[model samples]
Target: MGSIEQPEPTVKIPIIDVSGYLAGDPKATAACAAELREACENQGFLQVIGHSVSEATQKKFLDAISRFFALPTEEKEKLSQSNSPCYRGYEKIGGQKLDELDTNATTDQKEGFSIRPERPLGKFLAGPNQWPEESVVPGFKEAYMEYFWAVHSLSKAMFQLMALSLGLDRTYFDAFAADPDGICLCRAHHYPPTPPDAAGRTRGVGAHTDFGALTLLLQDTVGGLEVLHKRTGTWHSVLPVEGAYVCNIGDLMQRWTNNRYRSTMHRVISPLSHTDRYSCAFFNDGALDMMIEALPGCVPEGEKPAYEPLKVEKHIVERYVQSYGAGGTYIEQRA
Candidate 1:
């Protein structure tokens, strides 16, 4: 009897300043919700910084997303994503396989544009947004809706500091994000520059695990972004931090925190820098019929509520029909 080794995961990626919970300051918002509840229960990723959303408005929304990915691939395939319907638009370069929900994953070379919620909710991946010709990217729709409403108001102040780090009531996710209807989305990625004989089976995004409930990313400093230290299975590097805003915790906020927060498993490792790697995620995922459950102060008495309720838009359209299938009908087929 002799074979045991697990023990490495410790790269320490927490930067959470949150400017005293955006200056409401109740003792710096309880020390920023105890450092965002120990960085969302250890490495579900974090790195927010005062979050005032200005580095010249995230460099004018990454310079209008590098002028809409330097147009002309037939004018960005005339806003592709197979002419939307709810897939939003533009996706070109290796047009997403995002490891098509993993089958030994590997297809993501990256190139995106997605967008949702331009108010008119009605549900099911909301709708409307495929813009590109504000006279051909001159202020690309007002610098991407002013950095998407300033990171959707810092993801509703990070869901009230993730409900005051779970002791609840920091407006406990404000009635599941009631607003002009929430189910936020807003991608922008680009990636490009990874072709030296395709760099070992490509990947500017692959690992996966972020089906919603907070994402916020912003990147652009040409990093690569990795993270998956599940107890030393190794893969860390999430470096870039100028005006920080990496934040993570997804999988519907780790099933409403019953597993006590953690949705890790990130990736995007192609950039060794030939100069090309913008980013802009957003996500959020609330109120698509919001039900989620599990948060009775994150169940503990007799321990038994790991996750079941779930309904946020049918678990985000059944993880987008198990990661992009159903061609383009993310739920609405019932016959």
Candidate 2:
């Protein structure tokens, strides 16, 4: 019986094919919506297949990411993350604040580039990215911009699912849409080879929850992301499947559901002795002025309030600055 590996304490984390719903078929849309409810309550994470983000667009992002990260340290360092009003840029290894989460614990060992949707110079999360000039990286600006638009569209679909899962009409959130600009951002990561963790250490990104709404993850080759099943206290490897985007709920979902949903802790752990990893996350941010209050249908009665009503933009930016060591100055422009 002990050989069962303790069941790994996993939450099923449903797999849904979105092609039907996206094709304007009512039957498929209903089926997809039902599955999203199951996933949100059980794991708050799932594998999205049949999503229309073509493999070609995925290849473009992958190719551009490979080329961008392959640049020399001198060239990449020019766009280091410290230059942004919101700290979005190239971040060196072990950079980034996970906030009050084990600050003295070992820092994650990796480097990445952060890109966000376009907005006025003063907007915190929607500002332009610090792309490598074409001269330096050939077609980086062109590629990254194209990649951004593609993921942005997918993020919108995920948002609609969130609204429906909360027992609200699919268009409920449309009223709170960000100014002509939302705060969706993307991060392209590169993790170099690392030795195995001793007994209790983690690699890549640390054990923490995402601070926004849904996260659409794209990975290439190697894998290291792990999700901690709160019910079982066991960690499970987040397996990779080709042609699918891995989706996970964030703190926003947890709050909206009054804690019925899980925004569980996830971290990156090293593989064997030698391996490299590449990953990207399209962070789905709600509108700047949206009120992040609990959903009536989620908690019912006799359930304790899990989170206070918060302005999503404020909570997200506040957490981002704190997690990395900044003194809470990422002032997001209100819509």
Candidate 3:
């Protein structure tokens, strides 16, 4: 009899400790930045520890999301993302197709809710979030909003590290980070258990690069995320790291670094276990109008920029439209 095949072990994404950097220690900050440079250049994914977001805070936010996803279909549909012009609300399973490059790709098998800062109306994907009534889930809104700001603060610190990693002043990316027009999106995703007959036709999320500058992800221990190793053309599982956020650069970052830093492809498979999986992803895409071009130190001495400069929002909107179709259209037909 032939032996049974075993699943590949989870790959070890580089881990970095940044507590000292957060405390304004120049030496620790420099060391942290150096490690960041290596991870960005090679794997484009890393685990961040010592970020100081308490486990209680993380649990509160995730618990809120789990409660929201546990609602009945009819109740959830009332806050459907389709009703919002900016696409900020509950997204039903299969609402997005991330692997658009694949001719045979099917819709993703996940449900989610997206939230952005409650900015004034009149901007693309900017406006009030769709929240469930406090009666239904007391403190749900508060929990998520608190986490949003916490992660936002961490993202600014990350941008500073990224700038330093490129051999530029740590403040080189500050303007972009502080721009009010920057898009900071947070999402709660729930991947239900895979059907027995799914047969690999669906994914929790498909293989694709993120559309923004950086992504900070918090995932549960069920573990289905995988990253594509560009060098070897193989996929490896990304196991959960306790008390750490899994961070990765996105396409815009790749553009800014002239591809010196990679934007690796990643995807999630539906968990085969009876248990469900959940994740929270925060995307820190810089200012809408910021130009994406090679940074001063990112380009080689004689090589021209590999990518033409493009506005951050334009690139993001195009990618959203491609994935979300009419659901991704801007409110009031305004770009």
**lDDT values, one for every candidate:** 0.76, 0.74, 0.84
Q: Cα lDDT for residue 297, model 3?
A: 78
Q: What is the TM-score ranking, best to worst?
A: 3, 2, 1
TM-score-superior candidate, 1 or 2: 2
What TM-score number comes out for model 3?
0.94
Q: Which residue pairs show collisions in model 2? A: 97-323, 97-324, 99-323
| Candidate 2 RMSD to the correct structure | 4.3
Instruction: Compare the candidates by TM-score and give the number of the best one.
Output: 3
Q: Model 2 — which ten-residue stretch has the worst lDDT?
A: 1-10
lDDT of 2 by residue, 174-248 (tens): 654333566777889888876566443345676689988778999875767777776677878777778688899
* Candidate that beats the other on lDDT, 1 or 2, i.e. the better one: 1
Name every residue pair that clashes in candidate 1.
Answer: none
**Candidate 3's C-alpha lDDT?**
0.84
Give the alpha carbon lDDT tens digit for every residue of 1-335 in model 1.
11112223337688888887798979988888888898888778888888878889889888888888988789988888667666677876654454533565545667888786675535576767788878888988788888888888888888898888888888878766546677678889988886665434247777778888788898877777878776666877777888698988888888888878978888776744467888888887777777887877678788789777878877777777655552222334221
TM per model?
A: 0.32, 0.88, 0.94
